[model samples]
Target: MPASPDRLPLALYRAAQVRALDARLIAAGTPGFELMQRAAQAAWRALRRRWPQAGELCVLAGRGNNAGDGYLIALLAQRAGWRVRVLAVGDPAQLVGDAARAHAEARAGRVRIEPWSECAPLSGVLVDALLGTGLSGPVREPFAQAIRLINASGLPVLAVDIPSGLCADSGRVLGEAVRAELTVTFVGLKLGLFSLDGPDRCGALRFADLQGAAPLPAGEPPAAWRLAGERLPTLAARPRNVHKGQLGHALVVGGDTGFGGAALLAAESALRGGAGLVSLATREEHVAAALARRPEVMARGVRSANQIQELAATADVLVLGPGCGQGAWARSLLGGLGALDKPQVWDADALNLLAAGALAAPRGRWLATPHPGEAARLLGCSTAEVQADRAAAALELARCLNAVVVLKGLGSLIASPDGTLHLCDHGHPAMAGAGLGDVLAGLLGALLAQGLEPEAAARLGVWLHARAGERLGGAGRGLAAADLIEDIRHLLEEHSPCLN
Candidate 1:
């Protein structure tokens, strides 16, 4: 099958930044009203494409320009000989400037307009042009009720700009938000649309720059970038005479007692991820099982932290903390690696130990992968707080830990200590299984062992891991973590070929 076109832009902005872009456009040449008209036209086109058979449109309008887009879309539907009605959720009389003009145009165009009430009947397609990105707090009173009505209507809803009651800076839902089947956003893409709860509420998203043939206005740098296929870092093709020693060795440490499988999974992934030599130093009990499962991996039985310290001296990178318990054994292993300067990828129990003050946070070129819960612990806050503003939490963790931090969850964020951030909007709900984090840590270790910088290795490893899950996620449920390893290897080759 042919590849899908890249509808999503890489550059993502905060709500304020997008508004600034709009102002710059107006300052340069385009009139505010013309821009509003263009937005409506674009939305109308998308709506028609999404539901061509639906001949009726019920528009819920507010007092802002977002509602103005609804009014213009109503006019477009009316002109097209389709039945249309504008439910004035925000008093139309309160509209001003270009919004007022839009309402007047709809009125002149003979579109039926009425005040929105709790008992208002809804039918056909619903256009949610309510709060947009102007929501400063939780949804209040009548608008909240209106959003509830729209969500309960069981009608196909198209949200203009952004869904109401969602924070444009963070993806947190503010009290209530309209659940739309399609969202047509304009000017610039907002970062919130791809983070946290934004993906669930926004549904299918479509972006229109509205600049048309005009060059994109350079306002401010992007807040963060979306990791995609284009402009990715690639591994150089190997030389014909290269030997096994040329590639780096990666050591996997963890898996105490009952948790033996976790460390083995990491080691298996490291070998698959192209590490020249992979070693697993775990509890003596797991060595036989590890060798049985994967003979290629050099599995060693280690009883204490001293054993791992010896292994670390020859390893290029260490993939630490998968199934590493919080007992004294786990503590000893963590403490032993503290003085080592080897690059590392810390996940699972390693993070818990660090958060609990078991050892000072490791320095040097290292990467930390923490789920929202782990992130909250590291920040000394609640998980709810971390989820509320994930971008902020990730950056803060990166700064404090002095290492690249990967906040893994719905939208995985890779934040570098230098203040750079990247968001991976790939992966699927089916990937909500166990062992995925262990696989990711090992992949990062393999990439690091191959000589990529901490941040670059993290970015590439995350993309590869998530893309593998997405490819296999089509089977829906029962997605095992080990299933992603082979697919990741294949994808790595496709992205960065082995040979010229």
Candidate 2:
């Protein structure tokens, strides 16, 4: 919660995994009730630090262990002399196991407990303890109504473990979900918290290993990992006598007719991203503009696929798509690309063409970067289906296309051909603009051309692009696609410097 660099959790788990870890801890030594108490203490500490001046506390509680943690938090608050009240959404009398014990303890501590109602007055910080990760179906009546009320309460909210009604496995909003300003999770980080609707609902995530349950056992790999500076691939410093040829050449193919700027952006980004030599093969009308804007790029106007073949033959890597219209010319160019034996980064209309079955899937090394809509089309599903389970969609895409897939969105997911997944939690809202994906495609191509494997290039490129967007997005709205080029170069140098 407090942006302490060292405290961030790197590994992420599914709801079932976290639950298993909890059970393991309890079985080893710690009691379930004791764990619940520790969770409460952790949440209380975070709540105090976040809203220290606020003396009143209102907790919305349900009937699971999640509600048990809420009851314990209420007890702690009351003991600390803070005004505390617990509105029980689930029948308190029916509470069992650790939850019942916790409720008894809250009553013993003189914490006011009352049944929840639509008319219940909400004041001060609201604590959501209504549901936990076990939820798999759509939120039911009263709980749904309570979550809606919580959202409309205009009160700062602190969620226990996870926000109520949000799927811990997929981060999907099941009919509805509570939007918490801050959430305190225990044991391990949930996969859902960083993707889909998770990032939006879980405002600021705080992890506390109450039982020191991390450093999980061997052979139990996480569903995915959060991309951080330490985990990033290094582009180690180049030698003094290095030649341009050693760095590898990158060819950017696209920019059909009116969409030439997209190809130009990718070429320029590739050059800035450390590609040794960048070449642009676009429509004749756009070649002059590409050369004028970025004279360093070897811009060539190609009227037919045969002309592009000549350029492709000399290139080490190809960055395909980016404003490539799905017209006759675009089809002709894509058809010619199948014969080339080069690593390719396909994006934009290229992805659309692939989805429409107009272009054959590349047999050689390739990486596909697709937004939700493009991903939906590629998988023969709807955008909502792709969004509902982004990880699944990305992995499926990678397998189906036999290429690394970068599913670009709020929390972009990079899925390797072998099914390994990584997530980038960087970037900002201002980055939701045109041409950014083109920039990313170019950057990915540059990284690949520079000798990084497709998987590594995708992971590193996504991180660099997102990090640059975050830096520029601080200036508020209107972050153009080209604005990230310079910043990305700087970030790349800092993260994977050309000189030590």
lDDT of 2 by residue, 311-393 (tens): 99999999989988999988987777865789999999899998998988888999999999999999999999999889899
Tens-digit per-residue lDDT, 156-231, candidate 1: 9999999998898788899999988999999878888889889998999998889633334554477888887666
Candidate 1 local lDDT, residue 291: 90
Each prediction's whole-model lDDT (CA): 0.90, 0.91
TM-score of 1: 0.97
Superposed model 2: Cα runs more than 4 Å off: 1-6, 214-218
Inter-residue clash pairs, candidate 1: none
The positional error of residue 458 in candidate 1, measured at the CA in angstroms, is 1.0
The predictions' CA RMSDs to the true structure, in order, are 2.2, 1.9
- lDDT of model 1, residue 18: 83
